[model samples]
Target chain A: MRRAIGLILLLVLAAFLVSGMLLVHPFGAPYPTDMDDYIIENAQNQTGSNSVVASVVFDYRGLDTLGEATILFTAVTGVLLLLRAQKRKEGGS
Target chain B: MLSKIVRTVANQLVLFILIFGLYVIAHGHLTPGGGFQGGAVVVSGVVMLLVAFSSQDLKKSVRERVLSIMESTGALIFAILGFAGLGTVFFYNFLVGSPIFGRIPPTGPNSGDFWTGGFIPLMNFAVGLKVIAGLSAVVLAIALFARGEEMEE
Candidate 1:
């Protein structure tokens, strides 16, 4: 029973991934492009960036980048702290 | 350390990898890659160097304190840029029309110019620094730990 369920789930995910790569738009063929269209059209002129993706990431979605940077910082600090403790124990003993 | 031939090859390739990574970060506003992607590329090169030279040799040079400072600097620059546009709003494109890194191109796709993106290039550089320092430190620590050694505290 578990094997069958796992196989079905894997097939579903694989289909979704392949379809995405093939650019197969879903049922509602063209969803509202209101925001997407505006950004695509104006991102270059408004942000003075050649790469639309860069503009969206660093300008349009700057807060998200800030959050990501914070996460990286925290994770690195955590790793260093944990490792240092291991070193300390070795020395202490 | 690996064979002498492998060590020589890694040493030769390291500079090119660093250059390519910097190019990706520098032209981020004009290219497909950004800081994280470029930093990952650079880190891969570093890993190759580590494998070729051994973790002990790397520990001698890749000081943890310096890496920590670099990571902090990158984060500081990112935060400062975010706050610089506080007049209009947080993370505003305040440099859109200024003389420095603010030259809007013709609408639609065109040949990319370096000095076009407002503060994005700066942000790219900041993030690139952060990723390079933070990830290298983590990887170096792990490599040392595995070999029963401690990184310089």
Candidate 2:
């Protein structure tokens, strides 16, 4: 019974994914291009960057970048702290 | 640590890799790549060196303290830049009209200039530095651990 239910769930997920893809806008031509259009129109003059994507990442959505940096820093710190602790234990014995 | 040929190739290739990474980071405002992507490229090169010369040899030069300092510097700069724009709003592109990196590109398609991008390029460089240092330190730690050794202090 459990295996049958799992199979049915997997099939349902696959059907949803396929149907969603089929109904979605084709490739790069997304339906909601309002945000894209706005950025492309003013990014160069406003941010003074030729690359719209960079302008978006570093200027328009800078808080997102800040959060990403924080995550990376936190991860690196955790790894270093754990590794250093192991090293200390190794040295003591 | 591998063959002599591998070591020699890595020695010659590392410089070019560094140059390419810088190019990506520097031209971030005008090109497809940016801080995170360029930093990943540079870290890949560092990993190449680590494999070619052994982590034990590489860690001697790549101090964890220095990396930690660099990461802190990048994060600090990012925060400061955000705060600087609080006169209008956060990340307000304050340098758009000032002398430094303030040249607006011609509308539509045109050749890109380096003396533009307001604070984006600077932010790119900062993030690139943070990523390169942070990731290299992590990789070095992992490599040393794999060999049942700890990174040098």
- Top model number, lDDT: 1
Model 2: which residue pairs collide?
none
- lDDT digits (tens) for residues A5-35 of candidate 2: 9999999999999999899889877888898
Highest TM-score among the candidates is held by which one? Answer: 2
Tens-place lDDT per residue, model 2, B12-71, is: 999999999999999999999998999999999999998899988887887888988998
Clashing residue pairs for model 1: none
Candidate RMSDs in Å, in order, are 3.9, 2.5
**Tens digit of per-residue lDDT, candidate 1, span B1-153:** 999999999999999999999999999999899898888889989899999999999988889999999999999999999999999898998898999899998888788889889999999999999999999999999999899887766
What lDDT does model 2 reach? 0.90
Worst ten in a row by lDDT for model 1 chain B: B144-153
lDDT of each: 0.91, 0.90
**Model 2's DockQ?**
0.74
Residue runs of model 1 more than 4 Å from their true location after superposition? A1-30, A85-93
